[model samples]
Target: MSLLSTQHTLQAYYLGLFGRAADPDGLNYWLSQLESGTLALDDALMLMANSDEFSERLQLPADDDWLAQVYPAYFGRPVDAEGGGYWSSLAAQGVSAPVLLQSIMASATGADREALDATTSIARFYSQQVSPERYDPAQTLIQEGLRSNEALYAELAAMDEQFDALTVMEVGESLEGRPLYSASVGSGPRKLMIVTQQHGDEPTGTEAAMLLLEWLSGDSPEAQWLRSEISLTVMPRVNPDGFERWVQLASGEASPDTTIDPRRNSADIDLNRTWDSSETLDLALIPEALAVRQEIARFQPDLILDYHNQNNYINAAGELETISILWPTNDLIDDQVTATAQQAAVALAQGVAEFDYGFLSLFPGGDTPQIARNGLAIDGVPTLLIEQRGLEEMELIAYEGLAVNYNALSSALILEGLMSMIGVITELGSGGLTDIDPALALQIPDRGERIQYQDIYTLSDERIDKEGMPTETELQPEVVGVSAAVLDDALAA
Candidate 1:
């Protein structure tokens, strides 16, 4: 069988499995066009092979044999077994060959490049500009990459040395008597408040802050833009005591037999809901709550961002939502304040959506005064909370132990989240965010609640329902709000 001699018609039956990997129904449309000779075989194959849906379905060596049989379909002729074998070996490596692996690697390096050259999507922007090499998610999760209180201070000291504009200050102490630190960076008029680690178990937000510090320490355009345009107030870890317990566990001081999450502070409280008001900041005997409020009071930011993480949510239908944002509001706030916060929320969600279109959502904020995002809004300072779906959920399957996988995923999730924050600030800085519809934010559906939500399963491996708190929405991606596309368009323009 020669590659070019025979003109074999494409089989419309397998079109559902191959080209239209995302939509089974797409086969019906393509099938008619395919069988009618309207849609060329090459075009149909190209559509399926380059898709993210195909990437997930790609089974490597397992698919290699199936592909040996499918090559007749791929090339419109029975491909030589020897030739197919040569190509199959190459596909195992990341080096993509356009003709052989177009369906799997999505047109190989050369073809993908050609496609990328003609058009730009938010996904392409991240792949081109913010490559994973620049912002490593896994490296920081390792032992050396771990950010302990000591590690954070050391990094901060080095950051201060690297950038004179960012000076680390000791604001207060944790309940366990660890130093609580804050930083006032740049001299720009806009004061942006960034708080992290209100929950001791949540450490990636602080890691993201460290990444921010490192970025600002550079002479890059982003660092320079931040220096000249905004003053960032960062309290990287408010709950040092809780983090310390986790750190000790990570270091092997405590047995892994106990539950991995060391969430509470020295006095044992979820500090996020501890700040009722300035006078009522104390929750239980946890001093971390007041310490965080003191830092917030010092900055008096016009816009506030509270960062945290939640478990990755997967509904009964098997859809995943990795990030969720909130424009937290109270009765004292007006539509304008809500809109402004929504603006920030939308921008961040938009920034993140490029990475995974269906992974983000903008939901109602906590109505309680005790919630930091809501409590901060009572004073009319528009606050946005970025809650990344928990990377901790991916520990075992994604990597090694709970510590390693959790830490690495947390760093990655936070970096992705931080990108959205950066995109929001960039949109605001460029004056590209004027009169954008606020209702567009709600168009991003809230992620649905998973029926079997849990932290790491119990020691016996039971998938426990970790929290009784139910999310207000269901989880699915294809609702048609181009939140990320809108922000990406603004950024690209």
Candidate 2:
């Protein structure tokens, strides 16, 4: 078969099983397998039908109801009597679920085929916009080719057109002249400024910020309530030049240069460090950081969440740490700012605790006021640091011994960050963040020694649950009228 024919077949399998367009990695891998005669079209379809994403996405019963769902899922119609009887007999004769799905998909024709072709055409168009290294757990490198500068602009532009409430703007330009953009929405009294990917090498937070923006722009009742209660400003990607170089290094398009650090800007300045004393900073040296500072000055957010990715390390319990969080540890920060930052951190710790896979610990951050975690707080802007797992190691070791589902890890980090933001916004809107005790931030366990990826699973359940203390609503029910369960439902929704 021609390449086009093979792609159409694969696209149908992706649609029927995953309910989405194929990622370039998976599509290319399977296409090569078919073209090389290593696997037939039926073999590929059967394998995909039995994959974890397939089973998790469509939880069809193993009994006769499977036929009821499968026919409609693939062909856009329920099974007719004759087709139902044939599939039912096959099942009765002990045919497997994957095999059954493969058979049903093969039987499409006429209007069903026409519908499939039209939808597949649309899916193909979507598949084009997605980069080759877009998030895929099945692939080894979990956070590869995170949205390019162009892609980020495209997505933000589309969001601007789609959501009337969301406003996407160019806050400043990087030293390389790439426009630094910020998306702002909501109209409540409380304001939040969330900046992600200060370090170009750290890219997960960029995706998480985009996810949060889309959620805030949504029409759900919880989302609507959030808009009514708070204003938000999100700087999704701060260091595009560093990110561009990082991508080049990852894809082997560029050789490593001794003078250049992918974690800093093109001018070799650590963007996070430039914020040390925003008043006296040399703006020409770090244009990216200056852009962020200017936006913060104008927006004057009540709270700032600085999202970033750090090296992987096992917690004090020896289990791999999924995220490390910290409030301002700088002594120069005001007592009130420290307390408010602590409240936000405590709230975030409790929120992240709900996810079973999330391993939270205190980030062993610097006391230097240069980093946003301390710098902004010193200036009386409440800031919290979120250091998620999986970026430094990815560049250093190339995912060795990290036996994890990249897809799940990739998504969990984003959702965990988004939910943390939502939880904080909810509490801040209801005036519940300030009343909580500030000592809880000090109580968060310190990050343990760094370990190789292979050592992550060595220890079992001894990991500390630092935020084990009562949350805002738990400690003071009157402070936040919204129940924890209600807030949780809203975040999930």
Candidate 3:
């Protein structure tokens, strides 16, 4: 066929696969072949079943009869002795028609300018439809209540109350000399330190920390109680340079001309992996990670939860064998932590389900430990890595829709988990004791349940009996009530 004819034919094939006949003559020719037993129905079906769009429309039972009638002539009859059918003989390997079309369009005879333009247009269109639009990572922190470092520090400084008299420390500077801020809240015996934005891309946790800080500074009863109970030190933006780089990449304005480049700030080092090695850290003195290390040394937290987005399955830290509370030494802590993580997973799954979203489980050998989860666990600070489903390109664009729901659900889970720890500490500390047996700490059920994407779907399905804990509403009545009261009090305070 001529080049133009080939292109037209391919386009018609794609349209047919999508259940649309682009050229009536071409479609009728294929249909006539099937009727005459020249073109086997199975072969025609194979040609038509190349795209997700095609699979979606093939309403199985509804189209089964039509498919049965048309599939046999295109291909020879099935060789099975037990009444083998054409439906069972359909080709398994199907090409993605849209991708194929784009490739074909790119290689077609055209000027360089035209080709590049077509390719860029196609890519951008696909990305816009399928990828997440980028935003300032700090926006998530702000939504979570931290605001910017400057804003948070200024807010803290303005409040002259004794509770707000804690020291504000500027540990290190970003590449742009934006000072990293850490505020020491309270003088409690057990110090808890949280550092956010280890990966510039994962901004959800950073935002959550900021929101928690804002809540603490406000006049809510829970905030007041939390402040009195624990000395919380939070470093909001550990990687400002990386975050700025991410923002610039997302906006497509990193250079004089607009384009996207995924790199660790200007130096291009993965900040999460920079720890424990001088060579890596020296090549790129990630001010964020360095500053966070200083803060960690200054105020050692009993527990830590460093957040990141795992594009694959959702998982917490630790192996399945070590995930229970029945083990010795760290078992009680493990149990409580695991229960908390599981409960959070359930809450997150449910929250996403309300919006018809789902996520996969962080199976043992997947992408969790090789990243940051293993690093934190090895460092002796019990940490759990929370993952949100979807890619950066997908989630970041739909961020606004997903953020509030995720943030609220995550905040509640973290708070509940932390409170479980706090309750243990409070009981131990009230008797004028410095420490309690880790074994003696009662295990909180539902701490670290691995709620996979499949589980979320199963629960959300109309037919299945939902497993795991009750909804977030049942788990956090007090927090929910206080959140409502906080809003009312914010207007009144």
Candidate 4:
């Protein structure tokens, strides 16, 4: 084949294996071996084509290091080693290659590189082939699409008629003077707030929120009821500057060629950690956080949802543990909300399963209490934190294959379910507050197989042995007294 044809074939092959490049290093090695005449490309392709190992390696799990190496090459840019990993960029783009690759590899296989390449090329050609009669030139569909800030803003400007009822509130200016946009809709007495992109690299939620904004402002009957019954405030892009920086870095247009900085705004402070506390050195260091805080204080939303992505689990707040239908406050209303969210999650899990994606609820941790959910709960606004698997590690499957839109569709379903239960929200706050039972406290087992209660706390070293087995330590009378005091305070709440 001519060099042009070879390049075209290679591009097609690469596109065909969207989520499948199992053993990227091995693939590269095979390519090198072919170039050096050490191994025939046909033989190498045959090896990959026949092996289950190749298929297994294509699934990029959370701990896999191959993603760090392959993603940069695919994007035609070098990923930062000091920062998290290439998955960060994938999260920003709202797409995972591993999931897509799994689907591609299963569909095409051949003994020769040329044959494999041709098969992939044909596959891509057919996948993108659209009938002229059925295609609409004016219809805007953002399926698996990424747009820069300028392009997005332009699109929003053109679609202003659809968003006429939505009021744009400029909370603050980015370090680069870009006006941060927050959409406020509805005129109901009760206010609900949502913020996305707190970590700029996590853009799936941000995109989902934007899509929701458009849907709400449109003439849907559901939108009309939501507008009349509740006031919703949404901050779509909390870190526009970081988002722009990531875009530039991913596109190979970044100046100075420094590693990608994961922090928000100009000051480089973690916005999530800069909440109301003494550790907050520079309150103005993160203008985005300050702006959000001001908005929360002003609106005092009855409920809030902060969207984020994780490598492992989908989690909700601990506050949703019980049905609060017996309380008379807005915070208790979350029982129905929690139930609705769980039902939606089950549907989402079923959808993701079609693509072989694993789903689980997030574990309760100290970090959860320090962030938005716990902080908002203190102010009486019950919050739900939603987490989805990182985009870089999604499983690939065959039409319902890896390209299955689980995260996007799950988000929509959750929103739909929430809207359905909106009228019963006031009933959630009907439950009365109760103290935690000391008898229900979790017990930790020691290495000696001894059980301990709240009155006997163990130090880190004393808690575990050299082999990571739990260890036992005798508690001093004073220590036991102090533990009792702490437990009493805790249970008395």
lDDT of 3 by residue, 275-294 (tens): 44323446335666677767
Cand. 1 Cα-lDDT: 0.54
Candidate 4 TM-score versus the reference: 0.47
In TM-score terms, which candidate is top?
2
| Residue pairs with backbone overlap in model 1 | 49-103, 310-390, 448-473, 448-474, 448-475
For model 4, the stretches where C-alpha displacement exceeds 4 angstroms are 1-142, 156-161, 255-260, 277-279, 312-360, 367-370, 391-493
By lDDT rank, best first, the candidates go 2, 1, 4, 3
Ranking by TM-score: 2, 1, 4, 3
lDDT of 1 by residue, 377-423 (tens): 77677788877766354333112233111322333365465577676
Q: Enumerate clash totals for all models, in the order shown.
A: 5, 2, 33, 24
What lDDT score goes with residue 193 in model 4?
A: 74
Task: Give the per-residue lDDT of model 2 (tens digit) for 43-68.
Answer: 99778877888788665435556666
In candidate 1, which residue ranges exceed 4 Å CA deviation?
A: 1-127, 130-145, 250-252, 255-261, 278-284, 315-317, 391-408, 432-434, 451-493
Q: lDDT tens digits, residues 1-493, model 4? A: 1122332333333432333222234334555777788876345544443456545755432432544433322321222363334444443554544443333233322112222332333222222222333222222111222345665455455445457778766777766676666677777766667787676555556655555566556555546655676677887667777767655544334542363453356667566666534344565567787788778887777656666654432113211110011111234234444333333223323222222112233323343334665555544555555554333212111001222122222322222222223322222212211122212212211112112211111212222112321111100011100111111221122
**Candidate 1 vs 4: which has more lDDT:** 1
**What's the C-alpha lDDT at position 159 in model 3?**
42
